[model samples]
Target chain A: MELNLKLNLDASTLKADFPLLGREVNGKPIVYLDSAATSQKPQSVLDAMDDYYRSINANVHRGAYYIADLATTAMEETRSKVQRFIGAASPREIILTKNATEAINLVAHSWGREYLSEGDVIVTTIMEHHANIVPWHILCADRGTRLRWLNLNVNGNLKLDDLDETLDGARLVVLSAMSNVLGAIPPIRQIADAAHEKGAVVVLDGAQFVPHLPTDVAELGADFLAFSGHKMCGPTGIGVLWGREDLLEAMPPFLGGGEMILDVTTEGFLPNDLPWKFEAGTPPIAEAIGLGAAVDYLADIGMPAIREHDRKLTAYALRTLPGRFGDKLNIHGPADTSERGGVLSFTFGDIHAHDISQVLDGEAVCVRAGHHCAKPLMDTLGVTATARASVYLYNDESDIDALADALERVGDFFG
Target chain B: MPALEDLYREIVLDHYRNPRNRGELPCPPAKRAKGFNPLCGDEVIVFVEVDEGGRISDVRIDGQGCSISQAAASMMSVSVKGKTLSEARELERAFKTMMVIEGGGSPSSPADLGDLAALQGVKKFPVRIKCATLCWNTLSEGLTTE
Candidate 1:
């Protein structure tokens, strides 16, 4: 008989493990609904980072001392954890960078400069965060490449009706797995298949997607997959870029410095092996270990349960916000909860998003208000800004209720 | 410090709902300059028509933004209309003084900030202070531009 011994986890049990969750804001307990921005770290992640500094504090892969060896082992161990976390083929495919922004820049500078040239086409979606869109824009502007945009449908999902034509003669297709604004998870496999059929490489921005969903890079058919650790209950300084072994081997070093080199002479230098070649300088050592602990924590809770929790919270918000405010509250994105993640971006009546956020702040309700680093999506949505509330595993129905009650105050305050 | 009622004083909300001098003024004497709060994406356009003696004969504030910003602009337009450019500049300085406070605490000023005094509550909300200042900055920019 097979043994199943995973702990049955939910918000109440897991909420106690995070230190910040216990704190109060304005006399009321803080209802943290901004996980999409950055997740709250568990005690395990914090302890792991502190332990690394206390016991195994040393530079990695350089010093031959005992602590150096232990530090090196710990750092490299995080790489393997990350590879397994996302179901990448091997640790060699994972390149640890400063953050997702640096990861995208790595691909843009290394692969883009080598393969792309003037007049080549790069197709991207309008729903992308500036991180995914801006790098390609710089590449296009510099190389004189032509960039095409994939528009969104009326429901805020990508309108790939023109994918076949748009992918024609395209060199690369860059897009997000899930929109940070709309919370819509685009059909990544379908998009990857289409891009592959048109002989274009696919770069998937998984910053928002990987946190709430189970990511299998090889199965997703992405040549490059990027995500940040901070968004997934890890520290802010580290992020991952997973690439096909062949593609990574073909690309040049993103930043040339100490760790990324095998041998450096007065005249020239040879790059280091697979992942290290991309990780040029002193890496985010403690942060990587913390991310490894976060990966372990998530694995313990199980991604499926987390997904279910997120879905519940999202559905609750979707159902509650509409029922409470009717047409007065305009929540953007897909109507079906299954089609989207937990992010809810919306406007309440004629009140500006900043004002709504201010009123919400009074009730200790945390929601993000701005263009969400998605100006193109803002233009498409016909609004300059929206107040966004996103949920994670630790968020429960009570948090959603708090949000609803606070929103009522926002409406009344404006009225 | 995080009180909503303090920030949303009735006078401020009144100005937001029914702003004074809120449309475009006829040109020839009107000078318009735009201001933008890139973080909130709040925008304001300040138009001022100066008299022969460098006094503002008419002023109009137009834009889309939060209550604090729109109301600040509305109240600002009301205060500066028919005032000399130098007097308007003084009001702008006093308003800036009122908005800047240390550690989200209130700022003390011996001189009255006039109608713009209603916006001193914004000092408690540091993030919204930029929204409060967008109009005054635009008015300053408009006066200096020709």
Candidate 2:
């Protein structure tokens, strides 16, 4: 809540930072709680992207021309920046892709699809979004590998004790650092250690993790990590998949195209190198430059400060909402916010989540409703869907207040 | 805040509180169809018991849904009960006309709808369109089997 004052810039100044946020929706400023879907971009990121195309837009690594050289250099520079951002030891570990979904599919298609074979097990959890679930299903069925899952507790935390029991003979562990619906933070460090003892490489779907908390790949002990750019105040169509250098080097190329090839022959085409081998065809150049700007923007604020700010928002909502709505409101996820992000998925009596979202929309408060791409988790929660108000760096106490006020509207709407 | 009466109009609340024909009919005698709204997991199983006249004699619907959906189903089953196939189809066509984008997509005026006009307030909330149309689709799907 302290950071509310820190971000207390004038209306025009805030609009200057985010031009899109200035646009009125339903005759009011958009509160934009759908950051969990994708974050709004800062003007700095848009300007950075514009600067790239206007000055140095060209095909990467294909020409001797200066424009191409400039483009290629800026493109590769983002790789190093992302590597440092996640605390990976080398730039070679970061592979650029369209989004976290693509980054995950790359690993499943290239590395997991091949290395895994009959009876080899890949461990996951019911809490994963379908992006994490279906890919492994395809990989396992094709490769004859077995896909396993860790269960959820009544409070929605990953049942790690059950996870330990499932680890026997497991070759890979795929999990989200945070539950997308419940806002439960699984013990990544502990899960990684358990998987390591079992000789399994751990892969984290950090799409929910990287945006909320400070992420250090080495500290978390993940062999492969994937996250999208748009969740972290960057452009869509850009993401980073950080793997151990050895794994990427050994994994076959996911997509074969001009940017990723060393040479072509009637016999076969050889790959260029580690990062490029994963990225194929015309890359999202503007998005990557925008990602670099986003990295700069986040780093300037410092991750710990952002983490603490959201912790306060989550904690405050936990303390406040139950009293106001009483039995009419049921908050999903845990009561504690120290172990979670500011994703509050809740329901007002028997009101459907879409109706709750619509009522909120009328108040200029934007929250996400429906399954949030985590249907299995929704099943576990015993609700078809929930209305979720998620927060990011730009959100503050007033935003949370707006959310609470909107819920009162929802309660009346269904009365 | 708006008055509670303005938000939930008495009829909407009445349908929610006491939904009609709310339980399922046995599948063997009743022709049933399953409808799922992928946007949300609002699933409905509509069962129509057809008599020798080849008309819907007893339309019993079963499902779990949000208020709009459950109410719509509650309203729909009663509206079409014992109607001729032509009448039932007319209601379905009229419901779909209000729910989905119109053919060549002209916006629907409330005057075009009658008793179903109670649902026009729901049109303002685009997100709830699927909820308002769940039973209509179930009716559409169930009619095919009958």
Candidate 3:
């Protein structure tokens, strides 16, 4: 079969931007296909972080020195960039957290505890990553709240037919815009509208969606959106939790220390204003700067182009793998590429995912194999684990060809 | 490229394809234990029947895992089925010593391990040592449990 490779951006020139891609694994060139786990940072992001440390390193907000002011500016600039990247209303709505996991936890602890109570139902999907699932589970267990799960259809997307009924008594609905395992992009706008009609606030986990697709917070109609910098070519320690300005203003601070408090008297303390109220202590200043640089880099390339690249790559994989491997490979997700991102999770023959991962490592093909931290989704799919191959802007047809070649080797070696 | 022959040795594949002592032992004096490797969802349930003389009269291994894990379990069952409990424990120690991360050379020579020595290649792949040792760990837990 002919390969219809529609690459929006030239990977050859962009390949040099990520230094790690030039390195070798084992004896062969590293075929890094695990961008869903974490993308390799560009030299620009690294240089920006290094520049921050070299020139403008200081404590944010509290310091009176020149460097401190510059540092604060850099940090806030990142917040604005993130705001613009996701199309949030204002910078005041974006709260910096350690990671996406921490961001979700912040929502669960601050918002869930404050607004939700006994018998208050919160709806989440079967395909949510552990970060989104566990926090609500803990909140429900603690506050006597009832948790409802939206099931997956045969296509691996959330079955929204029963969503309105499920959201009837639900006070909140937290859903991922995309599945990390199945790569299924759900109808976030429709889900959000339905939840709002039922008087429930919607929280979208944009960790998988924001990096691969164009995310407009207002357009999506979600009250809160959370994502990490690491998955989008920045450093690991910084993440953004963007909430509706009104919602963020109403909720209490998640963490408290030096910065989050307006005044800490002996008897009591007053909380700081929006964003800062949620961000306590010294934040990830350097990582935030790096994230801003990464955001700038993505903006230069354009999210539309990146989205197209991902869809075309996903289309290529979906069309090629099954035709080549036939029944030997079983891919999980929507059959159509338009319904999913670039992530492909599958099993080759009866070989377990761990084994496939190990064998692929022989070919320097770095794919993720495990539950993908979505155990409930794994249960629904009737598999314990699957090997996931995900693509980003830097990847092209050569990477996919390398992957297919390695998978063929895996098939033959195992046989 | 990584040397595939070292990892997927002929004997290892044989045990994986046609595992020995797989299934359940009837209850009465038999004891069963379940173990899970949450990393890759490898689950093994070991059933052991110990005789009055403290020898393992029969041992059955049942699990679903990758080739390495399943093969390791199969080899482990074959190695320790007829041996006394103490002897099984000694072999377990030796096997773990072989799978150790640092200087992972076999403690007991190849002659000492007999058929189980085929798994010595697992020591090279650090991530896979747990897969090789899962059954042995499960067996230890099974024997110790009342």
Q: Which has the greatest DockQ? A: 1
Candidate 1, residues A1-415: lDDT per residue as tens digits?
Answer: 1122443447988899899999888888989999989999999999999999999999998999999999999999999988887888899999998788889999999999999999999999999999998898899888988889999888779998888998999999999999999999888899999999989999999999898887788779889999999999999999999999999998989898999999999999999999899987889899999999998888777777777778877988899879988999999999887789999999889889989888888888899998999999999899989999999988898999999999989867786
Clashing pairs in 1: none
**What is the lDDT of every predicted structure here?**
0.89, 0.81, 0.89
lDDT of 2 by residue, A1-415 (tens): 0112143223234445777777777677778787788888898998989999899989887789999999888888888878878899898888999898998999899888778888899999988988899899898778888888788877767786666789999999999988778788988999999999999998899898898788899899989999999999899999999999998999999988787889899999999887788888989988998999898777766677778877887897887888777888888876767778878888788888876776787888988888888887887778888988887777766777778887877766575
- Candidate with better lDDT, 1 vs 2: 1
Task: Between candidates 2 and 3, name the one with more favorable DockQ.
Answer: 3
- The DockQ-derived docking category for candidate 3 is medium
Output the better candidate (1/2) by TM-score. Answer: 1
True contacts kept of each: 0.81, 0.50, 0.92
Question: Candidates sorted by DockQ, descending order?
Answer: 1, 3, 2
- In model 3, the Cα lDDT at residue A350 comes to 85
TM-score of each: 0.96, 0.93, 0.97
Ranked by TM-score from best down, the candidates are 3, 1, 2
After superposition, candidate 2 runs with Cα above 4 Å error: A1-16, B1-9, B104-114
Chain A TM value for model 3: 0.97
Residue A1, candidate 2: C-alpha displacement in angstroms: 28
The predicted structure with the larger DockQ, 1 or 3, is 1
The weakest ten consecutive residues by lDDT in model 2 chain A span A1-10
Q: Is 1 or 2 the stronger prediction by DockQ?
A: 1
Q: List the residue pairs that clash in candidate 2.
A: none
